[model samples]
Target: MMLTCIAVDDEPLALRLIANFIEQTPFLQLVGSYSSAAAALRGLQQQTTAVDVLFLDIQMPDLNGLELARVLDKGPGTDKPRVVFTTAFNQYALEGYKVDALDYLLKPFDYAEFRRVADKALAYANATRPTAAEPALLPQEDYLYLKVEYQLVRVDFRDILYIEGLKDYVKVYRQSEARPLLSLSSLKSLEERLPARQFMRIHRSFIIALNQVKSVSRSTVQIGSATIPVSDRHREAFDQFLSRWK
Candidate 1:
């Protein structure tokens, strides 16, 4: 099922960008576009159809996105549309999540980031609604849910470079990200969930993505300049795999 959405931004360029993004996505349908929060509120009140998501800009002349979100929260029933806050300021991110926003997009974001948030909104929308006899929209299987602090963060499998075990926790290193994601999860538990063909546990504390391995030696493997040790227990298996790979 297509998820209905609306964009509200005082800036014409930003509003147009979000609208275009919504139109380009197969699962998202742009139902409304408003220049201000007050106008968006009025439009939403008049609409007979339910909006599944809102791409809202936090700063505006009056009735800012956060205020509008509060108003919607107290409006009527619990079927309120999920919010995804968009703003240039990073300060509002904590506030946005406190209001239970589905996602947050910073200004100057590309279509790829927008699409990621859209997918999250779609998954949330479908999960909350009643199941229909018709087959539901199939969610993409290329992602993994990692519990980061109090929230479950969706991380794409392709983005993962390696995972390092730290006692009861694991640090997930990604391709482009400078800092790894720290989760209260064991390496053994995550190893079970990872695709065996794509991932390999080369040491007691480390699991590396096979395809991300840039180079290998008798005792170590390199991924994007990060050298990870291959323990004696796993060296034979790694050598066997390398022989087959060669």
Candidate 2:
């Protein structure tokens, strides 16, 4: 399968070069190329098709590549792309891997060097993709098990107040609980399991139980004492839910 990819760089020359490489590659399809990290973020969030790979330059003006990668990783999507960092300095290589980067390409890299990393990304994409025999989503259930530290804790859907995403972990706040139950999972992962009618992701960091919401404003959702902001990206869906309730 051709891996769908995007390249982001502040320098026009660098961005053009990366775009050229992506177009020339047989297994890679260049979907979009952005001159800034912010533009890339917006494009990825709104795009309907899932991107398999991201070719990013580490240093940029407002939002750097590493920061952008983290945002995409924790953002409201299940198909998080494999990142390949491109930078002039090799110093950022260690930080790149912390965000689970597929590979690092130092600046002034030739077409041969770029192709090697592209090969690595292709191999990874092939390995992780789900086969026809393996279903992506399982049958929905009332309660789901979460890994809290070393123990597996079960949380019921009806009892859940809301869920918070912090980097790689999620905090599940349930009814009558003073402290939330922490789990080693992404909001996107949990989102897939939760019943759509009962829960809604109001923000990048929060997923609220629809039935438990006390009130909702133009930009926020109230659940008990906690108020969750409805992100601009998710506002339309939140508005639609309000219309349905009306």
Candidate 3:
């Protein structure tokens, strides 16, 4: 598979060198090359598909490479571009891994070194890339993939307690877990994708599995230790659903 990529560096020469290297690589495709992080970000925002990899320079004006990496890491999509930091300094190497960068290329490096890391990134991209067929959402399907921290995590539908919306993100509460799975997706998007017969949105910000509901009060639904509010807008529908249980 051809891995689409972009390069960002403050140095014009560095950008040109990386672009040239990418062009020569058979499996790599150079989508864009920018002199600054902001320009690269703007260009990425305009693209319909996420670039497969990014060759980033850590020390850039306005917005440094590290900050740019963090922003792209939390991008609003399942396919987050893998980052390969290109810097002259060795100090930021540790910081690069913190953001889960695929590889690092120290400056003054040659085409051989670039090719080595490029090959590694390509392998990773191919391994993690989802299959062409979308996951079936059948009634018997017990699990689904949720994009969390640049990785797609498989979550069993039965393990889910409820989902809480937090602006552009969602906190997926599941059984036997203290912390929720935070994902870069809207609750509405997840609500629409979930099996409607098994799950219901009881509030604008909440969606609960029908089986997980323990009890229903005047305006709240109980599930284990959590008490999720049933908003007026959703109350009538929820009442209709609860009627079937009786």
Model 2, C-alpha of 209: deviation from truth (Å): 37
Alpha carbon lDDT of each predicted model: 0.85, 0.85, 0.86
**Which ranking of candidates, highest TM-score first?**
3, 1, 2
- 81-166 per-residue lDDT for model 1 (tens digits): 88889899989865665466777899999999998888777766554455755332224346667756435677777899999999
- Output the number of the lDDT-best candidate: 3
Misplaced by over 4 Å in model 2 are 133-246
Error of 1 at 130 (Å): 1.3
**Estimated TM-score for each candidate:** 0.56, 0.55, 0.64
Tell me how candidate 1 scores on lDDT: 0.85
Model 2 residue 217 lDDT?
Answer: 86
Q: Please identify model 1 stretches exceeding 4 Å from their true place.
A: 134-246
Q: Which stretches of candidate 3 lie over 4 Å from their true place?
A: 12-27, 36-50, 58-142
